[model samples]
Target: MNIHQVSVNYAPEQDRLLIRINGKEGGELRAWLTRRLALALLPVLNQSATAQMTKLAGPAAPAASLDEQRDQLLDTFQKEALLRTGDFKTPYEDRQGQPANAVLGPEPLLLTEVKVTLMSSGQLRLQMLEKLPGSDTVRNFQVMMDGQLTNGLLHLLHQSLNASQWLEPVAPANLTPAGSSEVPELAIEPAKPRYLN
Candidate 1:
């Protein structure tokens, strides 16, 4: 399970963190997180507008209600998460082969499993792998953030991964030869994957 590339981003207003992952096996997974663990990112916003937001929304501020404070907290996460820029990479689609105005007709990729691995590099990475029908190989990917990780943040990560639909299969409506119930043929065709544009 080799990871090709990982792109992580956060939107504090919505309290959402997104990890866009690309795998060598030919698919992608987008992990969208929405919760309070994002507040752990205060240190990252020390110099940003988010810091000002927090100060203005202090506990004693009559105008700063609980919801308003929550909004400011989200800003902090966004300010922090947006610091990382990543390019999505994959071996599946050759953009040069695609013609202009070509809409995607391929089936959706299935997210097989999600896991967390503590790397020797001192980063706690989140890994998600996808599987195609009939192929023993799975498209695996892993990504981690480099920063201060709070307990609430760690729990949020665990909660987000556990709540996702990654455990279910996202197979196509039309079954291919590999998924057919018919008897196997003497010669088998290679799996040609198609993905959205």
Candidate 2:
């Protein structure tokens, strides 16, 4: 099944999920849910504050407590920043134009891991690990031409694309036409550098 539409929005604190599909065949709701779940999980995997704290704290302190505190702080900051930015709807409303027959399905095709890297040039690189039925693969995407960092989530969405080259398709041929029912085993490793202008 060809992925005619893909929409992903993620905040570090509150969970925001949204997806829409359209085509001759009625779209699968699970596909959208999976994308949302994957996007939501991105912050956790990409979090740098936690990593920085770990490096600073070393292996002696109670790592668990520090991790918990880090999560709490991250959540609070994310929420507050989102509110201040005022870009997203407080209560997310599903966008109009989704097919009527779309069914809400369970979440399984979601990415097991997502790593986001912020570069000096204000671009955000996203590396996603999606697990299908048998094998896993890493997909790389980028958000570029960013505005001031305060825009937070909205800024990322504004510049979102799946490829380093602005006009190229995000997923390669091997990863294209995201399967509706078939699940494959996927793994994510450190991705190569993708420049954003």
Candidate 3:
């Protein structure tokens, strides 16, 4: 699908991340990311991003190291650069006067399986699946995202995860603000919705 916009939000009652993607062709896809799935997805997402960034950096990419801090610094730099070009300030446009053209169905799929692949074209392909509760039927959808969009999706997901507090809290000393140094931490509060375009 040609993605036009994406929104990920944390639903406290459901305790799951609701991911909504609006396609350029006016079709929408919605999925639910549960805590168990989110935990499993974190490592894969990180590995794919690291690999893609290293490939883009070519031979100039820094050598793999045991220094965790150094690796985090590099990741922070890349994320900041990507966020600069993102269009998060623009609110996600809602389909007006009628229900959205949902690709799978009107209900959001409870994603039971997700496959991540880095294609030869340098775009990441995500195949999401939902196994019907009492049937052999399974519904699936796929989306291709470039590096920047991948980073943006990851960013928004992280914000949702942070709000959900599904993981342990980090030490205050380890906390660092996102975006440029000039931008205060309050500017990126969890209450604000982030749109990936």
lDDT of each: 0.43, 0.40, 0.78
- Cα lDDT tens digits for candidate 3, 1-197: 68888988899999899988887878678889999999899889878876766554444445577586587677767754763366888898765332244446677889999999988777788999998679787878888988778877887888888898888765444344676456334434468687999
Model 2 lDDT-worst window of ten = 141-150
Better of 1 and 3 by TM-score: 3
* Candidate 1's TM-score: 0.26
Model 1, 53-168: lDDT tens per residue? Answer: 33333344333588987776776666445433232232324322322212211322234444544444444455545565899766554555333332223434444444543335
**Top-scoring candidate (lDDT):** 3
Candidate 2 Cα errors over 4 Å, as ranges: 1-84, 89-109, 136-151, 154-197
Best prediction by TM-score: 3
lDDT of 2 by residue, 129-176 (tens): 444567555332222212222234333443442311333445743443
By TM-score: ranked, best first: 3, 2, 1
Deviation in Å, model 1, residue 106 alpha carbon:
8.7
Q: Model 2 Cα displacement at 175 (Å)?
A: 42
Candidate 2's error at 138, in angstroms?
6.0
TM-score of 3: 0.69
* lDDT preference between candidates 1 and 3, better one: 3
Query: What 10-residue stretch in candidate 3 is worst by lDDT?
Result: 95-104
